[model samples]
Structure formats: structure tokens, C-alpha cells
Target: MPVSSATSTAESPPAAVPSATVPHSWEYDGTEPFPEKEPAAPRDRGERLYVAVTAAIVLAPFLALGLAGWLLWGRLIHPADIVLALVLYTVTGLGVTVGFHRGLTHGGYRAVRPVRIALAVAGSMSFQGDVIGWVATHRRHHAFTDRPGDPHSPYRYGTHLRGQLRGLLHAHVGWLFRNSRTSAARYAPDLLADRDIRAVSRAFPALCLLTLALPFGLGWAIGGTLVHALTALLWAGLVRIALLHHVTWSVNSLCHVIGDRPFRTRRHDRATNLWPLALLSFGESWHNLHHADPTSARHGVDRGQLDPSAAVIGLLERLGWVSDVRWPTPDRVAARRV
Candidate 1:
């Protein structure tokens, strides 16, 4: 196969940083040594709900799956839970891959208004931060991977065992609570300029509710019982989120620390391809290839690597929902192979 001519703008020179003109008092890129004003304390009902939901998801799977077994308890685990979990995981995971990372961040292909908005909404259900913030942080990660400025690098701390453990923890989830946030103004000016994306960002809380409620509603209607609804909410909403969180976080922590570096990338960038997570991560575990070629659309470029996200993008393209698809060629991939 040959590399497609539809490569994205990521291969071009960096965009101008209009954020440099932002009001100084309000700027919070988390890079300044001392900001004049701190990011305002978390307020709003939505903020509180976000915190609580995140906590529940992180703790629920353990009690439902592990602690209950320890006490010889049963009931929390339902067959329907597993089925819903897999189904929701597939939908929301692709939301992050095809929607947030590839479509928004990398511009691997172009989507029409309806398709773009749908992607954003579906990804919002994943309960990751809004699109602008996610893209900003990710772009920052690419700007400075495994270096001082990478938002979620596992190597943030030194290589000592204690440091590595601490770094892993930070990369996995601790970084979310950090005072410093990636500036969407600096990194995602394209998204910030889009009124539709801004509106989608504002609707994230409602989208979260929709994500949780849809599965539970379907379960109640299908199973005709409150227990069934609860189980669906438990598995598809909370447990599924936890599973997605760790897998996405693993790409941040584990992909950098472990796996095979079969492709070369920026000097000092530690990204590697972790095969164990290929299917679960929807091909994003091909971190080495992704880091080597950021806008290729397909991360798992090798034969039999199984990139479902790429396949989805392909389907969408053929359906006329996406255009300028960037399919990789053997020559392009061969150039990056170590």
C-alpha cells in the first residue's frame, strides 16, 4: 500500500499562539512560576457532580467485583452488566479515539457538522473533560512528551523506584487534580474558535447524564425490573467508565514506561507500542507509531494490528461523513520502523 496524499495539518508548521495576547490576570497554563490569580475554586453543581461521579466510578468496580467476592457476596455482578459494559465501552472508547483524539486533535479527516457534533457528544459521555481541554492537554503532551512540559508523562519523576511509582500514579490520575491546566487558548485555538465546539463543551454535564441514563433506561425497559436497571447503570455507567479511564490512562503511564519501541520518534520521547491493550484501547496502544506519525488516522498500521477506530473512520469516510482520509502506506511506515 502507498501513503495517501491526505495527510493532515499536523505536518505543517505550528499554529500561531494567539493566547499570548490573553489577559495576564486570567491566564493559567500551569506553566507560569507564580500566577497573579489562581484558577477559581471549583464551583457550580456540575463541578461537584463531576468530582462525585469520578470517585464512584473509580471505587465501584472494586467493591462490585473484588470486595463482594471476599465477603462471599453475590448479586452485584449480573450477566447483563458485562454485556452492557462491553457495548458502552465500545461506543465511548471510539468516541475518544475517533472523535476527540483523531478528528479534533489531529484532523486526520474532515467531518460534516452533524457528524462532528455527534462525535463530540458521544465522547462527552465518556466523562473525560470537554473537547477543548482534552485536545489542549493532548497537544501539550505531543509538544513536550516525556519532557518537562508533557501533561501526563510517566517520566515526570526521576527513574528511582519510588519516583517511578509516584510518576505512574501522577500519570494515571493524579495529574487531573493538578493546579496547572493545559491552556486551550494556546494549544487548541482551532477548537476554541468554533462556536459549535464551545456549545458542546458547555453541554458536557447534560451529556454525562445522558450517557448514564440511556443504558439504565434501556435495561429497565428490557428487563422490566428495578434491579436490572441498577445493574445496567452499575456496569455500563460506573464500571465501564473505570475500565475506560485506566485504559486511557495506561496509554499515558504504561505505554511510556513499558512495551516495544519498534518505531522511532522524537529524541527522549519514551512512547512504545503495548500490544496487550490493542483491542481494549481501540488501537491507541500503538503509541510508538502514533507518536512517530501523529496524523496518520490509523495507529496500528502493521498488518493484523486491529485498529477498530481506523476502520470506523474508513466506514464514515465511505459513507460520506468524513473526507480527506489519511491512510498510511508501506513506505511511510517503513521509514519510521526502528
Candidate 2:
């Protein structure tokens, strides 16, 4: 007898299902073929609350110190405190200006091993994170300037006065609290490659403690009193850091928002020359010149600009500590004029 077409088709053992298209038998069994993955959710409000709380922890104490200093009738800060503050301020400021900014960021000058390590340590004592992190953020700042991804730009908010004021605050201190960290891999490859720098970066927290404690220790030795030590710690450590932070932030905020733009830069980049802050900011107030010629070791190119940082670099060069310094040429400066 001839087999019926329908029965023959049905009896063909399901036509030997193709391996590629067939569902795995394990999928239907007790075990799952693929592991289930939990979906990533947005960060909770509690995390944001923690960040705000931590920021207050860092900022509130300094604000109180400033207020107390202002309120106190007698000398809240003595001469010893002032001197110590000035000395440390100058050391750390030079470390950032010369070592981190010029040397690390732009390679404006080369230094010997000892000089490099010393500078990295000095900068670490400033409590501005590791040297690599500082250089990375700063380089990103220059690379993006006032653009969307700029770490701290006064223009990020808007041109309106209120917006600018908010932006100034953000640029000054708020950016530090941000969780979006700069990638050192992309921005600071050179520093990352240096073992000395990596080691110093790892030791940043200890150096910061020493920076604060050294003032108190010195004051105690000099004045032979705990009161003097406290005063010195407040003024030399806390107040000095606060002041430097603002000055540096001002270069990002006020320097971009206001001041004389004598030198031309890329369009919308309003880097300016605020001469009043030259000494206080260790010559960093010459923002226009810096933006114009970033590789030049001296930002205050004009006569009588009073760049103490530049003077320090010059002294270092004369002492054979820093070599191949990139001082600006007259032609280069002229070419940058508006």
C-alpha cells in the first residue's frame, strides 16, 4: 500500500530541526540558558544628599573660621601665622604654577629628578588632589575651555548676571564636589607613566595632613602655647587654602567673565588680564596671555606685571634646577594682540 503524503510528512521525526534555529533544551529545563541581569537604575536621592552633606563638611568649617576671624576684636591671626601662611602659600602656589601648570600640563620646562619629585610633593601638600588628577582636570579645562564639558567654566550657566554669579560659584567650589571625575588615562598619561609621580599621588592624603599639622607644630614651637598653635592652623592652613582656592577659581570665573581681553584667543574664549590678582594668584591673573601662549613659562609678559611665580621660575632656571624654559618671544606676544 502507498503511504499517504500527510502521514509520511508527520512521521518524519519533526524533519530533524535545524541546530541553528532550534531552541536549547536547557532553556525549558530548571536552568536558564542565559543569566538574568539586573538593570541599572538612576542614582538615588540619598546619594545626592550624601554629596551635599560631604561638601558642607569641607566648606562649612572654613566659612566659620573666616567669620570668626572677622568677628574677633583682637588678633585672630598673629604675625607668625601670617608668615607661615604666606610661606606655605608661596610654596604650594609655585608648585601648582610652575610644576603642575607649566611643567606637567604644557611641558614648558624640564626638571631634574629631585626637582620634579619635590614639586610634586609640594603640590600634593596643597590638598588639591593628586598631581595627576590636577593636571588632568586643568588640561581638560584648557581643551574644552567654556564648552559643555569644561570642568569649571563661568560661562556654562549663561551670560546673564545671575547665571554668571551661579556659574562663578560652581567654578569656584561646586565643581570639586562633582562625582564625574576626569579620566587620568586620557589626560595625564605622562604623569601616570612616571613611578615617582604615581607614588606621590598615592601619598596625597598624608601630605595634606602634614601640610595642616606643620603650621600648628611650628607655631607651638615658636609661641610655646596651644592657643597660638590653633591660630596658626586656622590661618596658615585653613584660611590660606581657602584663599588660594578662590584665587585659582577666579581665574576660571572672573577671568572669563570680566577683565581686559588684550590678547586674542579662540572665539568665545574670553580669557582676560586681571592685573590686580597678578601677585595674589602668583601671576595666573594674566589669563589672556596664558590662553594665548600656554607653553610659555611666563604668563605675565608685559613689563611691571609683578609675576612672583615667574620670578621663582627664573630663579630656579638660574640655579640650574629648571632647564629649557619656554619664555615668550616678542613676536609671539605681538601676534596674539587683539
Tell me, by lDDT, which candidate is best.
1
Question: For every model shown, what is its TM-score relative to the native structure?
Answer: 0.82, 0.83
- Candidate 2 Cα outliers beyond 4 Å, as residue runs: 1-61, 67-72
lDDT of 2 by residue, 307-331 (tens): 8777888988999998878889999
lDDT of 1: 0.77
- Assess each prediction's global lDDT (C-alpha) against the native: 0.77, 0.75
lDDT of model 2 at residue 2? 12
Tens-place lDDT per residue, model 1, 1-338, is 01122122234333432444345354333223221234478666876765676566566654554543443356565677678889889988999999998888887888988999888887888878788788778877887677656678776666678778888898988777553567787677788778898998999878888888987997788788998897787777766877898899999999998998889998667899999999999999999999998888999987779899999999999899998787788999999999
